[model samples]
Target: MYKIVKPLFFSLNPEAAHHTVTGGLQRFTKIWGAKSLLKNLYTVEDKRLEREVFGLKFKNPVGLAAGFDKNAAYIEEMAGLGFGFIEIGTVTPRPQPGNDKPRMFRLVADEALINRMGFNNQGADVAAGRLKRLKNKNGLIIGGNIGKNKVTPNEEAVNDYIYCFNALFDYVDYFVVNVSSPNTPGLRDLQEKAPLTHLLNTLQKLNEQKESPKPILLKIAPDLTDSQLDDIVDIVRDTHIAGVIATNTTISREGLQSEDALVQEAGGVSGKPLTKRSTEVVRYLATKSNGAFPIIGVGGIHSAADAIEKLEAGAALVQVYTGFIYEGPALVSDICKGLLKNK
Candidate 1:
C-alpha cells in the first residue's frame, strides 16, 4: 500500500506530502469499514505484546512519537493503523507558526529528515480540546509531549509547562517534558542541570498534589556529554519523575550520506544517522541510572530489530517518527511481528 503511494508523496515537498497523507487519512476514515480494513492489514494482536509501564498498560511497546500528530487531530486515524500508543504535541501554552518556510527537509538518500519546525503547533488548549473529543482511542495510550512557546521567556517557561500539563492532564495517559528539541530557540537551555531540575521538581510538586499523579518523563538530547547524562540521572531521582525519553534528535552531522546542501541545512537530524547514537544514549541512561527508572527509547527506529536493540539497551518502550515516514504504516506491524518472532 505505502509502496504504491510512496512515489506520489515523495513528489510533493516534505511538508506538503505530510499534509497530504494526514488529510487523505482524515478523509479515508469517513468511509465505513475503513478503520477495520486498516486494523486487519496493519495490526498484530497478541497477549505477549502487552506492556505495563509507569502505572499504565500498553497493548504493545510500539508508539508513534511526538511531532507526527502535534494537534492530537489524528488519534483515531493513526490508531486504525495499529499502535499501542500515540503521543501528541510538542505543543505549547499558546499556538505558534514556528519557523519560516522550507523548515522541513527530506534527505531521501539517508532515509532521514531535518526539521527546524520550532515547535510549530496549535497550542495546548486546542490539543486538549481535540483530545477531549477523541472517541476512537479504545486501548491506545496517549502521551502529551509538552513544551514552552518560542516567545515565552526562559524565566516564565515553568508557567508554560504548567499550563500544558494541567490542560492535558485529564486526556493523556502519560506526560513527556520536551526540553530536548533543538528547533526552538533557548528551549534546550532548560535542559541544563539547575533549570531542568527546577522545572521537573516544580512539575513533580504539582503532580504530587493530585489525587492520582501521572508519570512525568523528561526528554533529553543526544548531544549531551557523559557528565550531563549523570546530571540527568540525579535530576530524575531528585525530582522523582517517571523516567526519561533518551533523545529527541541530534544537532550533529558527522557521516550523513545525503548531499552537502541538505546536510548543511540547519535542524535536528533523525533517521539512520541516529540509530547507533540513540541506542547508545538509551544504554547510557539505563546503565548510568542502574535501571532505576523506565526509559522510552526513541530515535531512528526503522525496524523491529532497531526496536529490539533499544529494548536490549534497557528501554521499557520505543517510539518511531522518522521510521514511520521512511518505512511506512506497515512498519508498526512489522516491528510487532519481529518482536513476536524474537520471543
Candidate 2:
C-alpha cells in the first residue's frame, strides 16, 4: 500500500508531502476504530522486544527520532504505528517560523533528505499543553528534544534550554539537548566544549532539583572530529547526563549518488548515505567511553539489519526518520520482528 501511495507523495513537494501524510495520520487516528486498526496491522508485540534504558522501559528499542514529529501533535497516531517511542520537538521557548521556504529537499536518487528546518516549532508552552491533554499514550515513551531559539544568542542559550526543559519537564519521559543542527545560525557553535559542558551542567542542576528528575541526553552531530567526540564523552560523564543520542544530521555531502545541485543544498543530510558514518560515530562513543553511559543510535536506519548494526555498535536504543519516510510503517514491525528473530 505504501509503495503504491509513495509515488503520489513523492510527486508533491517534500515538505508538503510530509504535512500531508502526518496530517492525514493525525486525523485518521482521531476516528473511532483507526488507531486499533493501525496497531493490529503494524504493531509486533513480544516480550523479547522490551528494553530498559536510563530507567525507562521501552516496549521495543526502535523509536521515532526527534525532528520527524517536531511538535507533540501525533503521539497517539505514531504510537499506533508500532514504535516503542516517539520524540517530539527541537522546540523553543517561543514559536518561530524557522528558515524560509524550500527548507526541505529530497534526494530521490540517494533515498535521502536534506532539511534546514532550523528548529521551527510552535512554542514549548503549546506543546506542553497538548501533551497535558493526551489521555492515552498506549505505553509509548515520549522524549522531548529541545533547542534554543534562533534569535537567542549562544551566550544566553542556557536560559532558552532551561525554559523549554522546565515547561516540558512534567510532560516527557526524557529530554534531548540539541546543539548539532547545521541550519540554525551559530547553533553548532554551542557544541564546543565550554558551552556544551555549561549547557548540560545547567540542565542537570535543574533536573536534580525536580522531586523526580528525568533523564537528560545530549544529541551530537556526525560532523564532529574524534577529539570533539572525546570531549563529548567527558562532558557526559562530568555533567552526569543520562546518555548520548549519537548523531543528528550531517552537513557533509561526502559520498552521495544524488545530483551535485541537490547535494549542494545548504542543510543537514540524512538517509542511506549516512549509515556507515553514523554507525562509526556510535562505535567510537560506545568504545571510547567503555560503555560508561547509554547511547541512542540514529541516522540512516532503514532496515532490520541497519538497526541491529547500531545495537551491535553499542546503541541501547535506535531511532528512524528518513527511513520511515521512505519505507513506511511496515519498517517498524519489520525491525521488531527481526530483533526477535536475531534473539
Candidate 3:
C-alpha cells in the first residue's frame, strides 16, 4: 500500500510530505472507526512481546523514535499504528520555527534521509496541554524528548531542560535529554563531560524531588568517539538516570550514494546508512557498561532483521523513523511478528 503512494509523497518536498501524511493520519484517526481499524490491521498482541525496562512495561520493544510527532499531536493515531511506544518532541521551553526551509532532504538512492530540523516544535507547554486532554492513551508508553531553544545559549541550557522537564513530567511516561541534534548550533556541545553531567544531574535532582519520579534518559549522537561513550556510561551511573537512547542522528556522510550536493546539505543523516554504526554504538555502550542501563536502539530499522540486529546488539528496545517512512505502517507488525517467531 505504501509502495504505491510513496512516489507521490516523494514528489513533494520532504517536510511538506511529512506534514501532509501526519496531518492526514491525525484527521483519519478522528473518525469513529479509524483507530480500531488501524489497530486491527497493524497491532501484534502477545504476552511474549512484553518487555520491562527501567521499571516500565512495554507491550513490545519496538517504538517510534522522537522527532516524528514533535508536538504530541498524533499520539492516538500513532498508537493505533501498532508501535509499542511513541516518543514525541525535541520540544523546547518556548515555540520556535527552527532552521530555514529545505531543512529536510531525501536520499532516494541510499534509502536514507538528511534532516536539519533543529528541534523545531511547538513549546513544551502546548504539548503538555495536548497530553492533558488525551482521553484514552491505551497504555501506549510516551517518551518526551526535551531540548533547549536554539536562541538559548548553552550556558543557560540547564534552565531550558528543567522547564521542559517540569512541564512534561506529569504528562510523559519518561524523558529523553536531547543534546545530540546536529542542526542546533552548540547543542551538541552540551554532550561534553562537564556540561553533560551537569545537565543530567540537574534534571535528576528535579526528578528525585518528585514523588515517584519518572525515568530520565540521555539521547546521544552516533558521531561520538569511544571516549565520549565511556564518559556517557559514567554519566549515566553518576546521575542514576534511567538509560540511554543510542543515538540521535549522525553528521557523517561516509558511504552514501546520494548526490554530493544533497549529501553536503548540512544536517544529521538517518536511515539505512545508519544501521551498522548505530548498532555498533549500542553494542559498545551495552558491552562497555556491562548492561548497566537500558538502551533504546534506533536508526536504519526498516525490516525485522534490522530490528533483531539491534536487539542482538544489546538494545533493550528499538525505534524507527526513516524506515517507517519508506516501509509503511506494516513494518511495525512485521517487526513484532518476527520477534515473536524468533522468541
Candidate 4:
C-alpha cells in the first residue's frame, strides 16, 4: 500500500524518491499487465465521472497535475493508478539541468511541497518522441504543460513556447501554457497581458493550421492580481484559445504550519497553502468569463471535497499534484468515488 511506502519515500531526498517511485511503477507496469490490474482495483466506471471539456473527453474528472511525470515517463502506469488524465511536463524547448539539487523540499506538517525545480526536463522534442510512441489508448486524457527554458530571455520566450507547441501537436490531448513558475528568472514577466496574449496568439495561429487543432489553455500563477486575471479573460477571448488551468503554483508562503525557515527555503509553495488562492482563481475565471470558457482546477486538492469544490466553482475538470504526493494514489479513486456519490 502507498501508506506503507510513503515513509520510505519521504526518507530519501525528494528528487531521488521521485525517480525511484516512477521507475518502480514503470517496471511494475511492464510485468504481468500492471495497468490492467490497477484499473480493476482503482477505476470506477460511472457515467457521472465522465466529463467533456475543451473538446476532450475525460473518463473521470480527477487528474494528476503537471510536474509529476515531467518527461512523460509514467503515463501508462499513472493512468493505471486511476487518474482520469495526466498532465506531463513544463517541458522546455531545450533540455536543461534545471536548478541545483535539493530544490524540492517537503513541509510534511503542512501537507505541501516547495519546488524550485526550474523546468528540469528532457526537452520538448524528446518528450514528443516518447509521447508519440507511448500514446494513451484507454480513454485516459493527457495534457502537455509547456514552458520556456530558464536561460531563455523573456523577449524570445514565444519562440521557445512555439517550438514545444509544434513538437507536441500530434501527441497531447490538450496544451497548458506554463509561464507562471517562480523559479525561472523573468519567467513571471510573461504572465503580463501583452507578452502572454502575443505568445498565445502565435500558438493559436500555428494550432489553427492543423486539421484537428488541439485545445490551448493558459496556466496562471495563484499570485496574480484581479487585473491580471481580467487581462487573461480578455486574452482568452481575443486569441480564441481554449481555456485556463487556473494556477501553476504560488510564491506566497502565507498560512503555513511549517516554520518560517522551512517555508522560506525558497521556491513556489503548493498544497494546502495554495487551496484558497487557486479555488479563488477558478471562481474568478468562472465568473469573469461568464462560463464562456472552461477551467481545469489545480493546486491544493487533497480530498473529494476539494475536487468537488473546484467543479462547483466552475472547473470543467480538476487536477492534483501536491495532494497526490501527500495523500497517495488512493486519493484518485477517493475523488472519483466521491464524485460518483454526489452524482
| Model 2 bad stretches (over 4 Å) | none
Instruction: Estimate, for each residue in 1-343, the C-alpha lDDT of model 3 and write its tens digit.
Output: 8889989999999999999999999888889998889989999999999999999999999999999999999898898989999999989999999899989999999989999988889999999999999998888899999999999999999999999999999999999999999999999999999999999999998898999899999999999999999999999999999999988889998999999999999999999999999999999999999999999999899999999999999999999999999899999999999998898
**Alpha-carbon lDDT of model 3:** 0.94
TM-score list, all predictions: 0.99, 0.99, 0.99, 0.97
Clashes of 3: 0
lDDT of 2 at 284: 99
- Model 1, 193-298: lDDT tens digits are 9999999989999999998999999999999999999999999999999999987989999889889999999999998889999999999999988999999999
By summed lDDT, the worst window of 10 consecutive residues in model 3 runs over: 27-36
Candidate 4 residue-pair clash tally: 0
Q: Please write out the lDDT profile of model 4 over residues 11-120, one tens digit for every residue.
A: 99888988998888888888877777888988778887788888888889888889998998788888887888899998999999999988999998899999999999
Candidate 1 all-Cα RMSD: 0.7
What overall lDDT goes with each candidate model? Answer: 0.93, 0.94, 0.94, 0.89
Q: After superposing candidate 3 on the true structure, give the runs of residues whose Cα lies further than 4 Å from its correct spot.
A: none
Q: Which stretch of 10 consecutive residues in model 4 shows the poorest summed lDDT?
A: 133-142
Misplaced by over 4 Å in model 4 are none
Model 2 lDDT tens row, 31-103: 9989789989999999999999999999999999998888898888888999999999989999999999899
